[model samples]
Target: MSLNKETIRVMNVNIYCEYNISEKPPLILIHGYLSSTYTFHRIMSKLSENYSVIAIDLPGFGRSEKSKSFRYSFENYAQLIKEVMDYFHITRVTLVGHSMGGQVSLNVAKFYPEKVSKLILLNSSGYLKRANQLLILSSYLPFFHRYVHYHINKHDVKEELKKVLFNHSLITDEMMEEYKRPLLEKDFPHSLIRLLRHREGDLSSQDLNQIYTPALLIWGKQDEVVPFKVGQKLASELPNANLIAYDQAGHLITEEKPVEVVEQILKFA
Candidate 1:
């Protein structure tokens, strides 16, 4: 399928954000790590009718290409997003992020609380960083990325990808194709490495008591990436946050349970 209509001029990055521009209460959708705005395709279609759904493929992912040596830390990602929002003249908007995207969204909320009207994190990563330290250390290993390069052609990374998605049965063949298509393009893996290495851990935890923006935390009962129990700690820490756990779901809660997610977001938004 051609993704022609999903184009949007945001900052210097001509990002891929899909939405019905006429709708009210603009909402921005952010995808997880190693993923793209395509993750929200189905959700956006259903939401665009009543709300302006803007799903962006972050600077290093999907359609937006960054120059060589661009650092992909959570702070930089948050800044890029802020620039995009500013370019569009968005004052107060609802921010929804999944996994790594959730980390970025929370940082945006903490740093630019005035700009974000509400924060929605779907199985976010900030709640647990020590657990991800092993991946961070491995990404820094000498020639570790070479394995990723060699495996890309061998088509052996599906298992790792499955781990990220929590081995969900809802991951259809078509969805797998969509997830893997971007990696087929040259230079995608290098960008992925850059993002993984530079990402700063959860900024929300530094001063969790400061966040006054009404926040909603959603997680899957079976989420392997960020366990459901972590959401309880986050809810307890974030000043005004609430948690909603979806039974029988995995890491990709919004993707796996779009209706429930949309309903909760609408209630909070």
Candidate 2:
């Protein structure tokens, strides 16, 4: 159950990851925005027992390298996942993505269908609810930029961490520190701004129609980030998909309901 961590160079960038190779097609874990693979710690070891599991810190997050020059688009993120897969010579996989990672996973299935066999989305963010015009605009002004920077740096990430799940008591000092790590990284702020600036509406119903891969949607009914209603609509739109909602949980279904999430993932796969 111990995950072996490694750093491998890909396209001149060093990518950090923890993985275990077992069977042919592996279960790949993709973390959300401002998050590292550490969030998946609760479920990875158990799943790794029966399936080849790989969880990584996408570039600019976690232990991965960050560079202002790198593109932060969903396509770019998906391509990075492909690079990792190719590095391991893994051709087919079942992708498990959370929030922003879900958006990347959808793109991967849309553009690289052959590489994905099944998908598991935990409160995925393919559907953009509404845009914060002020925030996006503020990212441009120097004064506002520094203001935003200070806000991000000083914000008690634990407050938001509490929102990610239903129970605030579950928030741990270790988890708080892990989520705060990227904010301290030099280039992470710029990349975060870039991602926010590029934030667009959700994929159109027509656009989602193109993803024919079977998918499992695990959502928390109280999810504030991406509502359970979004998950319901997504399930209806995906050609082959089903959704499971936990009433007491919030956005962080994996952390809020790890056993349920892992059970559904294993059952679906």
Candidate 3:
């Protein structure tokens, strides 16, 4: 597959994205906290063969321009997706969101149902109540929020990846570099802080119930970050959804089981 990386100015922000043009009803891949389009690299080629695959670095993450103007809120990210879709002249899409991406997908499902024809939440965040008192309090103090993610070296990145992604063999040195790329950014701390504090304002149970879009929930049975029970709760809450729990996988199920994930997505989307 040809790698096509492009950038477009969106409201003064330089939004970077990767695209592979193909069949219609495009597939929009959204990544979670501290991640960019890199997280969806493995599956992008496979999906691109069948459908147009568009993966974006939402404002603060990946190669996208990060500034204080665009607050790292779910609604903001959802709006960005809408803008990108409009720019590309895409009328509808099959939205696939993993982790924090799931929250943004839910926000779009709640507000912009016309743009999203299908919704897939993979070990998504934003379901459970996540108001960390320490984090919240730290956000108020100057530079304290910055201090939280200031020290991100390779060792810590690997250890963090170990918790989220099962199967240590997949955690190669090159993979570590890809995961650490965004961590080295000067504004990474601010982006991390925004995600840490504002992520709590995610979809509620009522929001899940209200999402009538055809949805698929693929989760790892051993997901330590979000937990399998959370996926279960979300599947039950969603009016039209199916939950598929895979064994020997964790929060980074997309990376762990890309083949199965692509299979599931192809079957559903």
Candidate 4:
């Protein structure tokens, strides 16, 4: 299935997205930190078969504009998502968020419950504090953004993918190219510095408890970034949540196990 790619202006920012229409409530796919709609390419087609699928590149990531002035907090991100839904005339949706996106989805459900019918999180980041004082403090320095850019740009894409995927064979030329695209943008480094300074910590247990929306938490047992233990803790905290763990997967569960992820989504959402 071919997706319609478009860039919509919201809150003075150009938000990039790929979508396919369907009668069912839309499935909003939100990628993790430093990721984009490309992260969901593997599962979007199959998911579109059952529900309208909309995958977006959050501000400062992917094809989206890297605005130094845009607020990067999870609360603002949730609000931006709601505005996107309104732009498409969508009332309610099933939110499918991976990693950092998962935390954003939770904020949406917490603050705008009426807009979300279901929540699906894959290897979601949880119970984490904001950046360390030293990093946050250093972001105040004039040239810190350059240092941030240099640090990330120096890493080999293949090595980075290996750390996220349990199966190294899945790393490919296309994946590397897509992952590296944003780094080449001139404004990316500055935007990333703002994101690092503006991002808030994940919601606390009390906040998680208040979100009663039915949720499905999917975790990769081998995930090194956000381990399976986090999923177990989330399932226990969330009022209506169930977790499913995949032994062979890792941080990139959506890419590593698209079929299984789709199957579970069809079953739960």
Q: Local distance difference test, per candidate?
A: 0.75, 0.84, 0.85, 0.93
Across residues 2-65, which tens digit of lDDT does each residue of candidate 1 receive? Answer: 2235655554555766555553887888998778887777677767766776778887677767
lDDT value for model 1? 0.75
lDDT of 4 by residue, 1-269 (tens): 88999999998899999999878768999999889998899999998888899999999999999998899998899999999899889999999999999999999999899999999999999999988989889899888888988988999988998999999999889999999989989899988888888889999999999999999999999999999999999999999999999998999998899999999999988
Tens-place lDDT per residue, model 3, 1-269, is 77589998875678998998665559999998778888888898888888888899888878998666666767777888898888888989999999989989999888899889999999998555666788677787987645666555435888998998878778988778888887777877776677667655678887788899999999999899999998898899999999999999999987899999999999999
lDDT of 3 at 11: 59
**C-alpha positional error of residue 172 in candidate 3 after TM-score superposition, expressed in Å:** 1.0
Per the 3 Å backbone cut-off, how many clashing residue pairs does candidate 1 have? 0
Query: Model 2: which ten-residue window has the lowest total lDDT?
Result: 142-151
Lowest lDDT 10-mer window, candidate 3? 145-154
The segments of candidate 4 whose C-alpha lies over 4 angstroms from its true place after superposition are none
Give candidate 1's TM-score. Answer: 0.85
lDDT of 1 at 1: 23
Q: Which candidate number would show the highest TM-score if scored against the true structure?
A: 4
Q: What TM-score should be assigned to candidate 4?
A: 0.98
